[model samples]
Target: MIEVAGDSSRDGDWALVRLRVEGDRILEADADGLGARLGGLSLLEAAAVPGEPLAVDALANALGPIFRARRDSGRVAVAMSGGVDSAVALLRSGPKAIGVTLRLWLDPSGPSAERACCSPEAVLAARRTCHSLGLPHVTLDLRESFRRAVVEPFVRGYGRGETPNPCMRCNGSFRFGQLLDFARRAGADRLATGHYARIVERHGRLLLARAADAGKDQSYMLARLDPRRLRQIEFPLGDQSKERTRAEARAAGLEAAGRADSQEACFLAGDDLRAFLVRRGLAGESGAVVDDEGRELGRHDGFWQFTPGQRRGLGVATGTPLYALRTEPRANRVVVGPREALARRRVRASGRLFAPVERAEVKLRYRSPAVPARVEPASRGFVLHLDQPAYGVAAGQAAVLYEDDAVVGAGIISSSSAT
Candidate 1:
């Protein structure tokens, strides 16, 4: 059993809540008779009552001692996202775990900011999960850095008519890099996250592989990570199914157990990407939708809004269903054709590999099946010649190559051509 107490103040109303927890369940709670059922509520949640005032950062400072003790205790820094997966990860890491949440500055002009992963609301929820377990949590403010590192690139990619997966860049590069640095500074031994992926050794080199739950595998999003950093990272949930994680959290009385999963683009937070781009001053311009031979078929508000293989929202209906073949940002034109035109047996990708390979399975898109392909070494990048054609291959999207469930290498699809 553990005991925790914290103060909360909001809009001049100050209150304090204290709780006693026992084996994943709250035994008793006292909040000056605020009528809160503190049994299942985390300490931070109890402090977030209506008219209760408590700054999230201040709460972290108040709970600093809980973390300071673990600094030299071989602690593992767990990245919390205010969700069940992360909460269970911390639980498995034991009391020597410290929770860390990065607060990013989301687009102010977008929809409800509270919904995003790095929003203030999420940070508080994550802190609550930590406090419930008598563990310490810290929030890192990375608003400006996040904008420069992730958001700006996202806007620029869309402006250039390239469909970039911002999440991949964030997780593979920025997010994990920051977390690893934080873990080192905090005297922690390792950095852990709830991502459904694993690290395994292949021929004396560290390699990332799919999680036990293939359906929830996030290996593709992390395929671009610098391999040198793999040894210091940990994914405790890699072998557990999402269903089992949820069940563990629910058994522990964690509020996050029932929380919905976060959005793919945390910055978008359920807002339309096109609308978000327009608000960020990357608005699209009216353009012509043309056939492959440059014959105008219809008019479009903007070519940036359409991606290769998209069949809906074309605004121009041909006699048959049409798909976006390619987008020309220079001409501000969108090329539309039949679905068959989107097929490609070859993809020239530009990116480095974690390991050299002569043959591997190539996955063009997240949900698409991995196809058998021949990998040829090239000067600037590599080439994938698939045994069978795949549809909707687009530039700026990641082409991750795998060998026996391990992500051997990955690159951006620079071009896709018909066989």
Candidate 2:
């Protein structure tokens, strides 16, 4: 029997009793933490090793010096987002694991449509797993910082008539920066997360590559992670499939096992971007919708609420199907045109991050397929030569570059100059 003087609920002090059961009969406590009641777990499970208690103490006595030697070594600091990925990430970290989740605002509206990770519920999920695993946990409030780094840029980008990708900014500028700093403070040598991306040393420089599981690869979103930061980052889920990760979480008895994944732009609070914009004071500012020749076709509530290449909720009428061809920020006007108008071949990108490349696979948006492109250095930035024109490729959006499956670099699309 395992006895201790504390409550399991509040983490005062208690002994975790790992019991082996045979149809409700208590057999024994398995130290292997596998099917020995805890031993035969897969290699992916770091806690799957089985050990008898007496054996454990004997082994500890035998290996005490070695254990003590490594005890002072830096451990992994995990970023838990309240999902299976992060839940498993923390559980899989080695002996010195610590968990931390960020408190990000939930947007009132906008694509709660695209689901991925990050939300308030994710924070609690992370904490729960940490408690269950007997690990220390911390949560950092980042609402104001998120607004300045992500939300404000989104508003300004749309206001300037460009499709801004706040997610990329969050990954590159905010998430890694904040969490990595925390890792340093916590005496961790490495920061780990659930992002389905891989880092490998290529040509003496650390570079990002696609996860082995193609369906869950997240390299595009992480293109913004520079070599310096990428050096200190690790993705435990990169080599594992979602099914395997979930199974591992279940095996660990983590509370996040059955928890649902988070939605895109989750900070919006609700699913209405237009409503959120109105609340932000960009509402009620009606502007004109025009064509290239400056001919007014219709009117809009505000130009700051629209994005390029958008084909819905236009509130405009034309003989043919119209698409958001461009936005005239100075005029506060949105220009619509035939669907053909959306096709563009040459895309210009600013704020470029490159490893001296003249070619790469360019992904325009998260879901869009990467296409072969020639990267020509421009006087101010870089120019992308698409093999075939892409529709709705907008500025203020990120264009992640890949050599084969590894991301060599990425840039912010400035605009398209198509005839």
Candidate 3:
């Protein structure tokens, strides 16, 4: 049975909630009718502690001092990644910042095991840093939501022989969207992140711009943020160099100042995904790994072992180099082809998250240079006409759009077989 446990003061001063995430877990409820009344709350808080009384006023006061202090800069909800970037963001934003870190689930099985933004250790580190800086820290338990929104899609995408980019989805939609909801509920004004991207008003329209540090600029990964949300967000490291950011963090004496950078997709913690997948009970019954035209090249333990455009470790030693081009889930086979087969000049992206405007830059992958493209609106999606064909455009990956360097919007790459 589902239940909720919470404590509230006489005036509803503070509310502490304990939630049960799974069906097997029991959350005790106050049956005395004296339980705190959870009335109307914004959708964001509702996702966290549902059915709780509205503490809107309290949330407001809690956010008031910071907003007032900013006077010019405005209040911001900073996503703390338990690393130097976000740590410095929190310090720099000062009173206007509420540090938040999500505790995303780490699947025992998944490729590229690395410590992600969500881990017990990472959460604790973020909390300590926030407390040390005299700022309140909140841990948003988004494990279930994350699984549905990211992990599940990743697995399914891979199964379909596509490459997925969960970071774009999490950053552009789930994470920031939730933060904005938090701001509205708490009466805060804006949100911020340690991303090396910039936000500026160009020609009266807010734009997501590139950061000064090319090496650290994450505009590509964040190309999915809606243009409408730009006014309510901040990217402080945009104009600053990575070295200067470190210097600033050092000058502020933050613990995360010297902390090593967390690699992409922290949930994996460096574990091998194939093993994890097997542990998760998706062990393979051996499938055929084939070359173009249904020619059997070798065999794979499972279809999950391959992704679109993957070129290494094919097990089969063909005289000519080969790369994964597709996964035929129906046949439980992975399709391989020559390296030249990866190129594409046109991309059709559907279920797009934002509307397109004129010519923009399209990024095929993170850290990949932005390619000039004319993004044309296609129903609920978009069609990217690239200046030059881009190779390795995986269907599950995101086709993020940019104009003048800011992330305007993004969508899943539905097809990139454009010649």
Candidate 4:
């Protein structure tokens, strides 16, 4: 027999559950905490349990090992974010589906902490949705791992004078990695999600493609996912529009049907990047905003606060408007110049390509349009030779290459030039 414990605390109420198990059966169970609802009885009845806030904590912490020995090929594990899209995905996953949610780290002091997708409120909402559908729900408390994998890199990237896209890193590496592992341990053969992107086969290799709804396509954010793992994953909402997802949720009477979409950089918990960085020890230090000629134009708080192509916040007045060209973190300086100076015809990136291609359309930023580019192989990554000058190509941001609507490759922009 092995011992496992789980606990959940909110406001002031709390619950703790301890269980002694052998294989798939619970031999002994005990509960202790500050609440009357604290107990292990629900956990003993099933390998995965659906419950309130406290029960969710107990089961999420203790149920991993108990379900590891069972393998059910028909079971599908759906990733729920306590949103309408995920709820609709769960509804379409059929009866042999299990719901799973990841409880990630978020700033507790943030005003919008409750609105984060992985907040404690979201975890309970996910659990409630599963219970209402008579399906088991599991929560994986991955706050530490998420911080280590996604959050730290974000902070470091900014310190290096780069604008990092945390969502890309989270989706491409951190989030799916943990979810797939949990699915395997929970005896599920496939992990399904509500992502608005599709997986397609090209030359016998799986590649991510844009969703049917162009406005909601997330292929760029997910471009870093290894195609080899695509076989074990499913995107239930890839072909449907966001409207259809909300409609399905409403038809099923799901509480999240009309819920607003979660915001980006969820760990920030709705706080602005500047405030979040300050809290993370990236305090603002006085720096000089200089012109391309090395002449100081204005004063600023920190060089890390600016990125390439930023137009506002320079606090500089001139005959013509000046834009931020680049940041020199070590020098504590921000370089400002004319808008034309921000243009770049060449972008060097460090990453991988799923398919070999000589030419493709490249997306420099999330909302930016894909521009035509010639692909060149590099030592550690690929280079994009833009047919026309692309402005504001920031370092550390993803340069995703696409063939038609499918993402063929992606890399982080290391540097850019006009040549």
For TM-score, the strongest prediction is: 4
Instruction: Please give the RMSD to the true structure for each candidate, in Å.
Output: 7.1, 10.7, 8.7, 2.5
TM-scores of the models, in the given order? 0.85, 0.78, 0.78, 0.94
lDDT of 4 by residue, 44-77 (tens): 2353444455755665677743555367788888
How many pairs of residues in model 3 come into backbone collision?
18
**Candidate number of the best lDDT:** 4
lDDT for each residue of candidate 1 in 47-135, tens digit (9 for 90 to 100): 33332226344444333323222245577889988888889989988777878888887877777766578887888889789877877
Candidate 2 deviant stretches above 4 angstroms: 1-71, 106-120
Root-mean-square deviation of Cα positions for candidate 1 versus the true structure, in angstroms? 7.1
Clash count for each candidate, listed in order shown: 4, 22, 18, 0
Q: What's model 2's overall lDDT?
A: 0.69
Clashes of 1: 4
> What C-alpha lDDT values do all the predictions have?
0.80, 0.69, 0.67, 0.84
> Taking the tens digit of each residue's C-alpha lDDT, what string does model 2 give over 1-419?
22111112112422233433332123344333122442232111212122333332222222211111122245788998778888888877876687777776656444442233455456556656775676655556677788888888877776676777788889878889988877766667889998898988765678899999998898888888777888788898999899999899888777778877775566654467677766665655788988878888888887866676787878887668888888887878888888788887898886555467778888989899888888888866678898877888888888888887778778799878663
TM-score of 2: 0.78
Q: Candidate 3: misplaced stretches above 4 Å?
A: 1-75, 108-115, 351-356
Q: What is the model-wide C-alpha lDDT for candidate 3? A: 0.67
Name the regions of candidate 4 deviating beyond 4 angstroms. Answer: 31-52, 64-69
> How should the candidates be ordered by lDDT, best one leading?
4, 1, 2, 3
Question: Which model is ahead, 2 or 4, in terms of lDDT?
Answer: 4
